[model samples]
Target: MDKNHPKSISLTLAFSLTALIFYLPANFFPFMSIELYGNRNTSTIWGGIVVLVESGSWPIALIVFLASIVIPFFKLAILFYLALTATNGKHLQLKLKLYNITEAIGRWSMLDIFLLAVLVAILKLGPWTTVEPQMGSLLFALVVIFTMVASASFDPNLLKENPNGKVS
Candidate 1:
């Protein structure tokens, strides 16, 4: 669908901007709150991951950290780079690869959201060990969804070199 088209640039920018906006609150707010034995505590995404690591669940901790923090930031960076190059009509050889990777891994970012949802649903201990969704979880979920849409909407053809040795 005219991969190198201007529409692709617009889509990428829109996605990246939305993600960037959400990222701030996602990091600052708590992702989940737990109440146990009359004591209540809230955990941010990093805090949750730290708990997992401290409890000896390294794999899960790593996965959550990557999906929630690393991947989203990487995706945003890639999209911004792509958008910049696209606007200048500078054909980049790795455009296709970058776009594919962005789209492919976008859904993986949702892993954090899914985990939060599951925890909220399944971990209901009637005020003993309840898991409630936090503001950051909602923002993070929106970032993932918007980024996925943006990546999918981008056109790969924009990365192709023009006949005059120029981009697009």
Candidate 2:
């Protein structure tokens, strides 16, 4: 199928755009804020990782850092590259495999969101230590969801090029 196919191209473009837009704020904003003992503390996803590492939970910290920070950004970059190359009729077998892997990992990128949600739910101590959702969480969620949709919507056939170096 050609890249111009409405459903395939449009959905891929939409998801890629959304992922690009949301990724910025997701990394910049605080993911969670905690108010305890008349003091407020904030943590971005990375900040949480630092705290975890400092507290000697290195494994959990690394997992969260990689899954939440590294994976999402990597997935977005891969998706954008795939979409651009596909639209330009470039073909690469490895690109297709990378795209599929990105799609598979996209869902796991939501682990940070799930962790935040759980923290907020379980740590609501009514003025002791309250975890509030922050803008970063929202943006992060958007990034993950959009990437997932983009992967699903992308036309895998676009990766195949004709003899003339144009999409068939």
Candidate 3:
């Protein structure tokens, strides 16, 4: 019964919860604001997806929806589940697979941030047009970061431990 194992589980849960808490505002608030010819447009995660869909970029919209919204949330849930069941001996294989998936999808959570950065860099037309990241962008980045740390802090080997904390 190594103490670090439980500590790792606690850390994972803490980070995952924190990420979940931040996720709401990230999607609801405006992440990007664009001023074009004195007309302003502010877009949240859902708003961006809707705009993409309306612009006939269904594939890109789907990818953004999944990468920015779905994947981070899914990864957080998987990490939370893994932490909760780390000491249970049952379903070790399933837990391991889920943990691996969480780790794999962790990088994708930053897709929104990357896209926002590129947009800001590209759309800096002085006095006519500009793209700026808003508070939601910062919150979204935090959610992604916290979830990544949560996934990384999770000890997959704990799935092999029995209820007594001994490997079975």
Candidate 4:
């Protein structure tokens, strides 16, 4: 991998772009739908957070917002910065640390999906409340996966290499 660090960066950029592309619909489109007492409620990721905030669960709302919305965008921005700085010969260590952070916190971004899955499984109470995942949830999962792959494929050492991002 060291011998081909530049190539890894290229692949990382590709995956990061793909993840960013998936991010839009994941936030705006309906993530899940719940049916209860013959009423249906559809919610996107941000809508869930808004509902939580409105319902007085401020802490949970903040957590979901941070994990789902803030962190993904942070990771994407950091990845973009890392890729740019790697070739521009600037902020090598800071960007490397940021890269480590993005890699470490990557999985936690899927918390919303995990919670929804658990709710769907346990809420099978005969027309009381049934939760079903929608297309946006799948896209969000893909975004997480793609970003994780991008982070791992990124060679932080390349940031300190030549201005062209070629390995020594």
Per TM-score, the best of the predicted structures is 3
* TM-scores vs. true structure, each candidate: 0.86, 0.84, 0.92, 0.89
lDDT of 3 by residue, 48-134 (tens): 999999999999999999988888878887888888877767788899899888877766778889988888877884658989899
Model 4 ranges with Cα > 4 A deviation: 1-3, 125-127, 161-168
Candidate 2: residue 93 Cα off by (Å): 1.5
User: How does candidate 3 fare on TM-score?
Assistant: 0.92
RMSD value for candidate 2: 2.8
Candidate topping lDDT: 3
lDDT of 3 at 97: 90
Per-residue lDDT tens digits of candidate 1, residues 44-72?
A: 99898999999999999999988888888
Cα error, residue 164 of model 3, in Å, equals: 11
What's the C-alpha lDDT at position 70 in model 1? 89
Where in model 2 is the C-alpha error above 4 Å?
1-4, 87-91, 125-127, 160-168
Clashing pairs in 2: none
Q: Which pairs clash in model 3?
A: none
Cα lDDT tens digits, model 4, 23-129, are 99889989999998879999998899999999999999999899888999999999877776676666667877887798789769778778888888888856677
Q: Report the error of model 4 at residue 82, Å.
A: 0.8
The candidate with the higher lDDT, 3 or 4, is: 3
Candidate 4 TM-score over all chains jointly: 0.89
Candidate 3 total steric clashes: 0
Ranking by lDDT: 3, 4, 2, 1
